[model samples]
Target: MISLEEFKRSFKVALWFMFLTFPLLVIKVNPIERTVLWKWENMAFVGIGAFILSVLIRAFFIQKERSRNSSKNKRRFGYIGDEPLVQFILREPKYLYPLSGGVLIFALLFPALFDTYQTNIMTTALMYVVLGLGLNIVVGLAGLLDLGYVAFYLVGAYSYALLNYHFDIGFWMALPIGAMLAALFGIVLGFPVLRLRGDYLAIVTLGFGEIIRLVMENWNAFSHGPSGISNIPRPGFFGMDLSLDSAILYIYYLVVALVIITIFVVNRLQDSRLGRAWIALREDEIACQAMGIDKTKTKLTAFALGATWAGLVGVIFAAKTTFINPASFTFLESAIILSIVVLGGMGSILGVIFGALVLILLPEYLRVFSEYRMLAFGGILVVMMVFRPQGLIANVRRTYQFKKSTKGGDS
Candidate 1:
């Protein structure tokens, strides 16, 4: 139902946007040529687009309000909303097994179906998938705000780059080495921020990341200054010489395997004792500690385990690109990773995976829009935050339902 009031509001919104973007979208100037161009068509385009967007947004809100009212009515009647579709499918083994098998089969055959470039893109997405899952442990389950997670990522990358350049270490051997080094760095970082929380902890982590990046940039002998290390070898396949495409496919399969392993491990960890401790710590540090959970140990383990995944992915990133640079591991990278976790529904494995794919792959495809792509991306994010702050698929905590025993029931 489109109301006249809504249309009036949308029209105002369109006018506002047109006015705001007049100089940029509707006008152009050439300095050397001494020319001015007035593009009224651009203004019209902007107005139409803005009006449509505003209308859609208003309609969405109206529908949401209706749903909320309905939900409240249902709750009063001792009913509840339906579970999310994915959760329902996952819970029913009949649906889950077939869906899982189909997905797995498709994933296994993806390289064959797609070109090398697509495979490369998927590999990057999968790498982020692992990174998101790792950070999920700290930020999602543990509720620790980390702004310098890229520091551990930086550590893993440089560990491989430096080790390979100096010691000629291979990928198989360097993988674990890089991951362990990152975990060690995580432990080091955890110690100093033991008492800090919220913004203060975030600041410390951000500073640590900046410090690491500066050190890498300035240390000429160590990290080759800003020129970066190039020609880093990709992961080898059983001593076989693979061409470029073959190497890409191999790496794709390898990352696929890594993503699976990461998902499995993270899922298991979420069900484990430490996982609960992290969740408790996220909920209430004081209460968690009062419950006899070691806050220090819990925090440290979260950091270490999260860093391990970042490190593993970092090494793969370096190997995949066959290059390493300080610029690659920036604060923006950390922000993007964090965004994936937040957008995907932190602490939810499936949500993280969905978020990774959308964040990583969307921009690539949006390249067609060129200059307008980032604008579109930012707009989508803003809309998402306003409409669904809980993320696309909110994490559903496991719980137990108890039935009253007939024999012991009170009369």
Candidate 2:
């Protein structure tokens, strides 16, 4: 049996050989002109080749390590016991604030650098971030698999649309009402499904989302059905109409403000007692129940809170588009939002944001290849899952620090 060290050395050698051979394989082929090759196909080929190579190398290393370990008795050992190296670094609380503050500052000040299209994409991404964060509260922390999150979003949009259309209410007043309505629906939905678990719960929530869509479609009396609501109101600034002048800039600032508020609320929730309980429930509901936590209340709160955020984003979506219909709140939308949460690393706030950004913006960035955009997007998702299953930003373990007293304390 090959020792782990020797196997690892051989694997490294093989990897270097593959790397050197890849260019040679493509060089003589001359499949297409260099200029045209640079446009798309060649780029994709190179990317795919590199990805495959990396995967093989990683697999080789893992297998080599395993093989070496399996025959440990046959190899001479250096010592009876080996201690792993441990490094402890003191991290100041201030470190977090700088990262968050810098991102906000850059986003706020650099509005002009981003084109109108990019700004629109960013708005959509931010909306998803809100949705993902809200869903994170439910599915990530509370362990609820909600498939009707987009229903709350629909409720929010329609709330604003119907209220403004009938009562002449502005976006500002309708925003809160929309959120409340969605939260109410969330609680209502949670009541029946609370008894169900796993697949049953997922199916029920999915049915609820479809029911909302069907209601919007068939109930022409209220939703306008297939035609849907049009000419919705845009968000304004203290009676200053965004439509009158630089609407994009005004909307951008509004979105930034909303994003900040969402982040603040989520961060606070994650640090609160409720947050810990939710996490405990996620790990094991029976254990949580044993600890005297009321499962019903915790689950309901998660549902309501998650729906509330989705509703808020709905209001923004309506205001931003100035129109909406049943089509906007489809199953695909829910899937995308759920994907954001999962791909971002369920419980991680920043991970969800990064996931939303990448998923939403990547297609827009690749618009030049409109025909192949979705295929490329799918490939990217596959690559990401295979490579970074933990997500773009892995969850950081929380380390509690204690200051030792000089009088008498163990360091």
Candidate 3:
């Protein structure tokens, strides 16, 4: 039997979801027909069903989790190995080459393992992974909040789009050039907002992103306005005449390679002197400055590096879609990337990768819950903030901090 408090909690959740469902149900625009339709009854069913399911799942899962955690805690001493070597191999990062190799093999063959629809989804997921990593450098490592990171992505896409259209630059040849342009733009944006932090910094970056998108949308001569540039060249190797399947497989492999490279680079950077400096800066700007780290130089390099990653993704995105448009690079894109970083565990290598895959793929898989996506997202953010503000998977450093803080608590 449920208690009064439990009933109250569930009732409030139901009310919130009911409120959320009203908007999605009452308004629907059919893109093909260019018509609006209202379906209040349909939405009402969806909302009421969701509320019931959520309450049931929450009540059931909460008790189950408590029991599972309790049992595991009690059984831990009996299961865990006493041997130091066994423990070291299990815990240490350096001993995980075999695991990494298996994952790499699986990723390289991912396209062949699934149908076109699924493979396309995987590709999209990896692209966001790349974007998340790029933003990780700024927000995760440097402790900066950037809301206009999509500007760099836009720059990269348009750079490749224009170069390929006019100069006949191949995808391979134009990729680096596009990334460089984005890095340059990053520096341009970085200079003006060097002193700002938190909300002020976010607003400036958001505005900068909007400005880039608006320019692309209105600049009819260069970007061709809303029509977008088409027939963008795809990446290929050594003049190979490839079929559609082969071409897609090739692209998948290439992205996997890039993801591997990104993982390696980010991991190395996270362990390097520069990464430590970024963390210090993130912890406290004044404190880092007092330690003799040049504020301007360090911050600019962080921005440029982060933007370069986004720029690379932009080039790949243009190639993947075979077109470019201002609509593709919006503030929402920036928000999603940032969300990936935050959800994954900022400053945690494994966290970012897992975060990207979960956030991207979960939505794709939850198509049945399409109308409730935003509602679910809002709930997730709120829950994470209240329960595990550190993230889904906290970095070891952050985990240690949590433990240390709790150790001194009166309770």
lDDT tens digits by residue: candidate 1, 275-338: 9999999999999999999999999999999999999999998998999999998898898888
Would you list the clashing residue pairs of candidate 2?
none
Models sorted by lDDT, best on top: 1, 3, 2
lDDT of 3 by residue, 132-198 (tens): 9999999999988999999999999998999988988988888899889999999999999999999
Arrange candidates by TM-score, descending.
Answer: 1, 3, 2
Least well predicted 10-residue stretch by lDDT in candidate 1:
72-81
The TM-score leader among the candidates is: 1
lDDT (Cα, tens digit) per residue for candidate 2, span 179-243: 99999999999999888878899999999999998899899998888887888868767887665
Estimate candidate 2's alpha-carbon lDDT, on a 0 to 1 scale.
0.79
**Model 3 lDDT, full chain set:** 0.84
lDDT of each: 0.90, 0.79, 0.84
- Candidate no. 3 TM-score: 0.79
Residue pairs with backbone overlap in model 1: none
**Which whole-number lDDT from 0 to 100 does residue 96 have in model 2?**
55
Q: Is candidate 2 or candidate 3 better by lDDT?
A: 3
Model 1: CA > 4 A from native? 8-50, 71-81, 372-374, 401-403, 406-411
**Positional deviation of residue 240's Cα in model 2 after best superposition, in angstroms:** 2.7
Which parts of model 2 are misplaced by more than 4 Å? 1-91, 369-387, 403-411
